[model samples]
Target: MMLRGALVPGMIALPALAAAFWAYAGEHAALSALAGAATVFVILVVGLLGITAVVLGPAATSMAGAGVVYLGQLILIVTVVLVLRGVDWLDGRAFALSAIAQTLLMQVGQVVGYVRARHEIHPGSLDRGAAS
Candidate 1:
């Protein structure tokens, strides 16, 4: 459910960014960007999936469950960074930049999803009717 909103922007961005990097840098940078973006997309989806249960559960448990899921997500990212650091072929700068871009795009998607969700739960039409 959450993955729908979170993944859209990243998927839309990947091809354009990869093509741009290919034009300016080379095959290596382009592949690096693709790899980085893919890695982030997988991680984000996993994180969102992990939180789905928490988000659907009792309100009181939501915050604590989210906290744990996020902590694990951070650790997973750090591990990926460390493991990738030893690679010789990957362009570090391109990889890092692509990851950052993907992360930002996902954040934007999350915000949009939140707003959409809020309206669905308590739309203005309902409020106006209540006020009548």
Candidate 2:
């Protein structure tokens, strides 16, 4: 559980760092696109976390923490997107497609990670414990 908790932040940090790098490089257009995409990603992650929290109750600590991080990221992304849109750097279609694609990719990543983590934590415990 501790290891999983540690890894959750690391998982989020990758995309956050990438977005920050793009923003820092003065690639305003690219940064805006990335920010828009990140917003969608964060929304999807938060939705997933909410579902997990409902199902798992108090055991959903990691998911809840991840959701909070995603929320913060979402706010940053939305602010960047709005700023870019106001400045005329982001086109409608490009912005929309970027957000859609990022959401899909983030969902896939989350599902895969969840499955992999479950397997790691459970291993053969279910079968072995059942036999005992």
Candidate 3:
């Protein structure tokens, strides 16, 4: 589910951001932006979804273990971002813009996905009992 939600936003943001960067900047910038966006998206989805699986699976039997997993994922993400920042091939402006855009879009997609899911599971005031 997390992957599904993230995929929608990633698909929406990547091409749009790539096109914008290409028009305003150049091929390198566009490519860098797309790469950065993809990296961020993968990090987010994998970290969250992976932890979710662990939590739901037999590996994480307690909330404390889940918390530890979450912390580990955060550290891994930060490490990746820091490493990416030092890379010579990265375009700082495009990378920053793409990261921000993709993150925001992911948040929006998650909210929409949650609402749609909630409505599907149980029709409330917002859903109005409408058919999914």
Candidate 4:
């Protein structure tokens, strides 16, 4: 039940993300607003996944979830860069570096958020399951 609830946001966001990406790609000139919206949606998905992994059982899923999240982020970055480059909106070199930087930042943020949530929920002991 808890795991299902935790996954709800990511599940919902996935479709919205697809729609946003489609819309962006369909446009002759993608709007910065659209890019920002897509980025926000991705962030939300990452946050939800990170939180879900943390809350359910950090030790059990943290590494795996983080790896998956990181990979997804890399894919997203590549997709975004390809789209932007195809549209001539961003230079390839700059976009590539930006993508790498963004992934690192996101990973750090996820770790911090997970640690905070873990402590908040279980004060001292870290052995308790998230369902507790």
Candidate 5:
């Protein structure tokens, strides 16, 4: 569900990031921007999948497990960025911007999911129709 939520945001962020890089830094920077987006996409998906398989799957429905998974993923993301920062193929500014944006949007999606989930689990708790 988290991944699904990110789909639309990714669609929006990626193209905008690309365009921004192209306009500000030219074709080479645009390439780096796309690469940065792809890298983040792969990292998040794989990290989430790993977490799902290892912790979330067995725990099933446990929010604590999800939190742990997210913490781990966050650490992994930071580590990856630090390690790859010096790579020649990566445009540092573009990579930093896109990665940061992607990560922030993912966090926002998670929060929204949590809110919707809380509402679903308790129906009328968040229902605007209740006032009608």
Candidate 6:
């Protein structure tokens, strides 16, 4: 639920983070940050698509599907880092820092989006988590 809406805040955070990286660091760092941050966003979107497929299936299959998606994403992310590490123009410090920050920001966005949205767990739906 929150994952769809979470992207907005995540997008907003990127520019701010990039500006900070540019100001405190330098042009190379800024470029590295932009690349790293954007890559994370793309990876997250792709993972979401993979998970969405899981959501529409049977309960028995859902857990395995979700696990596979998560594990696959982790492998993809590590592979990206390794490949990027070999690039002569890349800044490992900036890339890793930016990626970590972007990840945390996106997760925070998801939580905030979830809290702000109306959900079935509230009093309006059938399962209110109250004793009858």
Task: Summarize candidate 5's per-residue lDDT along 104-132 as a digit string, tens digits.
Answer: 77657756654554535466755765566
- Backbone clash tally for model 1? 0
- lDDT by residue (1-132, candidate 2, tens digit) is 323432354356446644654565545545555656656655555555555555566664766665676676567656756766676655544455556556555656665576556643577885685599
lDDT of 6 by residue, 1-115 (tens): 6676658866976787778788988888888888788888878768877887897899899999999998998888898998889888777888888888888887787777666
Report the alpha-carbon TM-score of model 6 versus the true structure. 0.84
Top TM-score prediction, candidate number:
1
Worst 10 residues of 3 by lDDT: 118-127
Candidate 5 TM-score versus the reference: 0.68
- Report the lDDT tens digits of candidate 4 across residue range 17-55: 435544655332224334543454466456556646664
TM-scores vs. true structure, each candidate: 0.85, 0.44, 0.71, 0.40, 0.68, 0.84
lDDT of each: 0.84, 0.57, 0.76, 0.49, 0.72, 0.80
- Poorest stretch of ten by lDDT in candidate 5: 112-121
Candidate with better TM-score, 1 vs 5: 1
Best-first order by lDDT: 1, 6, 3, 5, 2, 4
Report the poorest 10 consecutive residues by lDDT, candidate 6: 123-132
Q: Write the per-residue lDDT of candidate 1 for residues 33-96, one digit (tens) a residue.
A: 8878888888888888889878899999999999999998888888888899899979988888
lDDT of 3 by residue, 1-132 (tens): 555776787887888898899999999899878976777677667766766677677754757766777687568757767888888878988987898788778877766666666534444655565555
Look at candidate 3 and tell me the lDDT of residue 120. 48
Error of 1 at 19 (Å): 1.3
Which sections of candidate 1 miss by over 4 Å? 120-132
Off by over 4 Å in 5: 47-64, 117-123, 127-132
Pairs of colliding residues, candidate 2: none
